[model samples]
Target: MRKLFSYVLSLCLLVGLFAFNGGTAEAATGLTIKDLAGRTVTFDRTPKRVVVLSPGDLHTLQALGVQVVGRPTSATPVDASLQSVPQVGNIHQPNFEKIVSLQPDVVIAGTSFLGHIQKAQSLGLKVVITSGSSVNDIKSSITLLGKLFNKAQKAKVLVGKIDSKVKKYSKTKTKVRAVILFGSGASSLVALPTSFSGDVLAKAGGENIAASFSQLKDYPGYANLSTERIIASNPDVIFIITHANHAETKKAMIKLMSTSSWRNLKAVKNKNVIFLPSELFAASPGVKITNALDHMNKELLKVRAKMKK
Candidate 1:
């Protein structure tokens, strides 16, 4: 009777061990997700080696506490921990050879590089595409990446922070007419409601003057609004997002504002022109969006207060 009991107990232990291992194996190989390009990607396991082809993706991964093997080349400062990571190239022109040599398990890209996606895929690199064009898109990217990296809790926290800020600022009773310009002066493109910065302005209770302009053919989210139309709108605030050096851009903008044609504009006359920080508003901003929202909201509030006075 003792020998028979021992045999049964050993058999049960073996079965339990097998069951546990099986479940783990299934989980290791069962991940499947869809990219912004409408393609389904399957992973054998959680990615251990990742290469980010855009600055925004790099920022997203960093926020999730995921270390990357390679990052896109940029003039902007990166986290201190990632300073040593290999640069695979910029957003529009990635260094394919270096990326292939890195042998990354996956590469995260943005929607602007659709043409390069297939090229990277052909080289046997799995590319996941994301967009950072709108506030919703930023939140969605954070959520999606959290799932991919198994950091759902952290993503939730970050997204919740953004939601709280939006809710708080969206309640502003003052409605200010505003215009977001990419670059400066006549060469600048006006942001439409469909753009990221424009979306933020709208969310903060500011009316986008360029919303009614016809979208540009090449860039649907921006338009070439004439100086005459801009003056006609007489926006309460003019938010300038610079692509070049901030001081230089501001100087050029000041020069333009002093011109007889633009000097009489309401925003110029009232000193309501604000040059947004390039780090927050120039790019997608990734996890730093909360700071951007706060800055814009505070500036708008000051404008409101001045209006009342």
Candidate 2:
């Protein structure tokens, strides 16, 4: 009886020690997370060699201080830290040979790169696709990236900064009527209410005038706006984003504003016509959305002050 009691008490003491040590156990293999596609992606641990495929994903990685082994050639190295990172290929196309050589734990990509994802998966590579269309989608992407890298706290900080900017812009007592015109010469495409820029404008206390009209034929999220409508609606401000690259865009902006028909409008007359940067308006601003919103709000507020004058 004494011998049996000793053995049982030893077992009980071991059980108590284990319980005191925090009963949680890590899986020997890996962990699973949901990407933007809602697909379950597994990771052995936080990826050591990450390949980011888009600017938005780059922003996420930069925010978390995660190591990136590869990136698309087009992605502008935003800081000195990313200047030395190697390029794999363009977002739409990736050099599989180069990626395989790197032996990356996972490849981060934009939702637009489904083909890239398939190709990478075929080569036994892990990929996490992020959705980044609107402000909310960008925030979700940041959160997902944070989860993948175990940098949940950094993700919270990023989301908090974006939310703070949103709250600051959303507090306008009155909405300023605004229109975002794109294209050049006769190609006057306006961003619709459903579009990302349009959404940003609305959030920044500017009412998108183009929301009232149906998208131009097959253009979907965009409609060809005419100078006639500008005269009729008489918006408080006009923000233009041209499709052309480089100096041509600024020239087109000048040309658009120089048209005799647009000169008489109140927005044009009051110097409220703004030509936004292509980085913010044309391509994905990624983590730069916070700065973009701040710039846009400043421009809009300038217009408002001018209107008061």
Candidate 3:
């Protein structure tokens, strides 16, 4: 009777061990996600060594606490904290030789770098392509990164903050017509669609002049418009996003507008021109978007006050 009882006890222990191991394996399974460029990627496991090809990817990876073994030269100064990381050239054109030397397990890239995707795969490197130029794209990238790094909880928290800020700022009752001038002058004006800057402007309780134009399925960049077009639009407020060193360039553009025949347009006549930090508007999500939103909020308040008077 004692021998039979011992045999039963050993059998139960073996079953429990198998169940535990199976559960662990399931938990460690790598995830499969779609990139912005419409590529399906699968990670065998959490990536320990990563190479980031874009500033946005770098920023997102850092937020997720992933170790970036390689980055682009433009990413130099490496977030101060990551200054020790090696440079692998710029995302527009990456040095595959240097990237291979780094032996990165995974490479994170943007839609612009889709051309190199096949080469990366041929070298036996895993790659993820991120899509969209809007805030929604940012959110998706964050969640995808979270899944890749097994940091889904952290991604949720960060996204929640962004969503909350957008919701709160969007509640302003007053609405004003606004234009986002990328080049600082009336002649070089390009309208940002609701898909890109529209949601940010809307969050600030301002209307984008581009909204008045025909609805475009995709966001347009560096749109060229004639002086006559500017006059016809007649926007109430103008927001300029230019390079930091190009403040004078913006001023020059503004001066040129003043000399134009339509200098009397409402925005110019009232000096409603507002210049924003160039880097903040650069295409990446996260705190940068928050910074842009804050600047927009302040500018909108100024426009609101002026309109009330």
The TM-scores, one per candidate, come to 0.89, 0.82, 0.81
Poorly placed runs, candidate 1 (over 4 Å) = 1-28, 245-247
Q: Which stretches of candidate 2 lie over 4 Å from their true place?
A: 1-29, 75-77, 93-97, 216-220, 226-228
**Weakest ten-residue segment in model 2 by summed lDDT:** 20-29
Taking the tens digit of each residue's C-alpha lDDT, what string does model 2 give over 54-130? 76678668877887988777633357877777888756778889889989998888777776676778899998888
Instruction: Identify the superior model by TM-score, candidate 1 or candidate 3.
Output: 1
Question: Candidate 3: TM-score?
Answer: 0.81
For residues 1-309, write the lDDT of model 3, one tens digit per residue: 999999999989777765764433423455677776777887665677888877767777777677788976762244677777888875568899989998887888877777787888898888887753677788788888887777888889877877887788868845778777665454354656644565677776788766655443433544555566667778888777664348586777668657856478788788887776655564564435666677778888888899889
lDDT of 1: 0.84
Residue-pair clashes per prediction, in order, are 0, 0, 1
The TM-score between candidate 1 and the true structure equals 0.89
Better of 1 and 2 by TM-score: 1
Instruction: Show where candidate 3 strays beyond 4 Å.
Output: 1-28, 75-78, 183-189, 214-222, 243-248
